[model samples]
Target chain A: MVWKIQGVEGENYLESIKNFLNQLLKSKNVDAVLVPKRFPDGNNTAQVLITDPGKLDDIDPLAPVQMVNSAQIVKELTKDPVKEKIASVLRPCEVRATIELIKLKQILDARLYIIGYDCPGVYNVKDYIEKLEKSNGIGKEGFTLSYVNSFLSGKQDTIRESCQLCTHFTGNSADINIAWVGSNSSDVFIEVNSEKGQSLIEGLAGEKIGDLIERNQKINKILDERKKRQENEIDDFLGFMQRCIRCYNCREVCPLCYCKECLLKPEKMGYSSDRYLRRATKKGQIKMPVDTVLYHLTKINHMAFSCVSCGLCEQACPMDIPLGRIYNVFGRKAQALFDYEPGRSLDDELPVATFKEDELKEIEDVKE
Target chain B: MGKNSVDFEPKIIAFLCNWCAYAGADLAGTSRTQYPSNIRIIKLMCTGALDPTYVIKVLLEGADGVLIGGCHPGDCHYINGNYKARRRVAILKSSLETAGLESERVWLRWISASEGVYFAETVKEMVEHIKKLGPNPLKMEWAI
Candidate 1:
């Protein structure tokens, strides 16, 4: 089912979303809400858990900055069962990552409402802060609304590289998808993608619009551009990876890299001083930070199949390696070979965890 | 150490699943089957238990090639272990390609315990392939 949450009078899309979230809080449909909101300083937005309706004043779900993938937040919130149902307003990448996390048993599905929105993509945190600084107290809502407008108008080019290349910007997997793409300024399109969404907005009033041709066209155009960029950017992977200092920030922020005891940890890597000296001796001279390539290779081997291409890892990288693109390229190939979509549905088994007996027969055929 | 490509004597690390490949290797030895002596075998409980890290480590340590020997499909003692191994190898190879490494340096083959001749032939074939591919760049190299 589809519904429209009418935009508030004399307010922009962001304000209307805040008003909708306020109503959601007041209606008691969910016991709590998790949405992005400006911090007290009002310069950045981060995901916040709100229980009081009045606190919705600072809500800014459409902010062009993402400090972290909120799937990690969902994992933390639902790792243990909660009695109260919590509605999480996420970007498409976050929702997909959350779904992948759910499959990995990192996040519990019960007592959680996954609410996602049409992602206009986001800027790297540093880039966002720079843009915020330049806007100079235009206020969070004002700045973000303009940023999103310019991005939608195709005048903005500061979106993170991963986001620009993202094809899965629609929150099709969410229970409730709050769509603004191709919708008029005065209303938001609420798509009930699942039964949970259907029951949640049971009495919400709005004209049920038919399938959006303009939105589909826009999505296709963006995807084509992204695919072209992805193709163009494929050559610089090795050169970019050469600069890695091996801080492991990429692993730290990766939503799919959910390991209780990560094998890539220095201790688990079984690195000894003697071993390092031996390696250095064997090579005559080894780089101070060894296993940089091996680290990436091992990580890709572990989670490439489950990768959601959220780009949080790339954002966290100080070395500026295009890890998001690299992982996505590798992930897409591996997932394609198995015909697996990481977060397409809960029913789709992870490629690594399950196997068909006759699958990958070419790998079985011994080359003589 | 200064040997030319013709007499390079490639160092091939073979991870053999205990249920089939390892037993198959043992059979080849007992049956006096002749094959290249270049392969160094590490017996694993199952190929599914083989981590990609082990393969990466050996390759980086300068092994000319990696040969993964799993049980034939449906013949794994752990049921679907070999099937899982196949999937992993596929993923590993794709990742290697993305890293701009030679993925062909790794080979996955199935050998049943009864197929001693096949085991010997596989070792000979893997050694020849590795010889043609030359030494792994990571082998005794300071840079990747």
Candidate 2:
């Protein structure tokens, strides 16, 4: 059953969500709440753990700005079992990455209540800060609700490229999904997807809403447009990779690149001075800080299946390389070979971690 | 197959599993089976141990081609190393191809210990293919 939280008088979309989170905290159900709050820098936003109901005032979990994927944050929170229950409010992509992390055994035993929302795509941090300054006089919530309404109406185009093509913006894997797309940013809807989500909304002030036909149609429209625009148009990989200085910032920002002992590290790659000189001599010449392409290829081989296509890698690249689009193209193709969608479910096996005895025979000994 | 790139000799890195492919190469050597002197063989305990990083390293470091030989399906000495290798190679090749590189430069072939003639023929076929493709494009370029 879908429940609708009617907006209180004079409350915008952001205020409605804040009030909802405040009630959930006072429900005596969850122990602590993790949410994205504006940093002291007055520009960036990051996840903040709140234990008191009073601390929910300055929070804007529905803000259209994501500097980092919260999957890494969730993994850190649940690394050791929580003392009690903790509720994490996250975006759709963060929820996807969280599910993948749980499957990869990165998250330990803990009571994690996942609160996901229909993400109205995010801006690169720079753009978000600039937008904040442009609307500086208005309060944060006032600016955010207008932003959400605009995004829901399909007027903005400055969202990150990955967000434009994201088919999972509806929080498909979360236990509880907060939807605002078809509600016109006025009536916030809470969708309980699991048993834990039911408890979070227990005895709350809301009416049981019926079929979400309008909401479903709007979501389907977005999905259709993104699907049509999902083709890989990269023509020359060599030319595209010309500006890489081999800094590996893409790997550092990727949520799925969770290996503690990465083989791509310079020490692990074993590129001694002698080996570099010999390789340059052997090839008549070689890239000085070599293996930029190799690093990408190996990373793709290792974590492409787990990639959520969140575009944090592209945001992190100092060279402004479009690493997000490249991974999205290749990662989806790799997953499609086995008919696997990473982070879709906890039951589905990772393609790289498991294999069938009699399957994928065509790949071996074949020229193709 | 005498079609040639004249003086251009392609460098091939052959990661041959010891139980099957390496033994097959040894058998080819003892049986007077002649193959092109293009491949530099590195023996591994199993194809499962063959990380894609090595293949990528040699390719980026300017090896013309890579040939990973292992046991056929249901014939793996470690029970299923070849199967895993097959999947890994499939992913690696797709990643390479999507990035606009020639996935054909890397080949995954099954060569059993008893298939000594097959091993020599596979090497001959690979050498010919590489010769036709000429030197690896990454060979002359210094900025990878």
In model 2, the runs with Cα more than 4 Å from the true position are A5-10, A40-42, A202-208, A366-368, B1-6
Give candidate 1 regions above 4 Å deviation. Answer: A6-10, A236-238, A366-368, B1-5
Would you give me the overall lDDT of model 1?
0.83
TM per candidate:
0.96, 0.93
For model 2, how does the per-residue alpha-carbon lDDT over A271-296 read when each residue is reduced to its tens digit?
A: 89899888889767776677788888
lDDT of 2 at B104: 84
Give lDDT tens digits, candidate 1, residues B1-144.
544668689989999999899999999999999998898999999999999989987887788888999888888899888888888999998777767777888999989899999999988888777777777877766665
Most DockQ-accurate candidate: 1
Q: Which residue pairs come into collision in candidate 2?
A: none
The sequence of per-residue lDDT tens digits that candidate 1 reaches over residues A1-368 is: 56766443227777677777777777778889999989988988889999998988878888888888899999999978879989999999899899998988889989889998888888999988888889986776788888878867875467887898788988889998887787655467788899888766655555676787777787787778787776422575556767988898998888888898999888998889999998888878888677887888888899888888889988999987888788888888888888988888888988878898767776665454
**What are the chain A TM-scores of the candidates, in order?**
0.94, 0.94
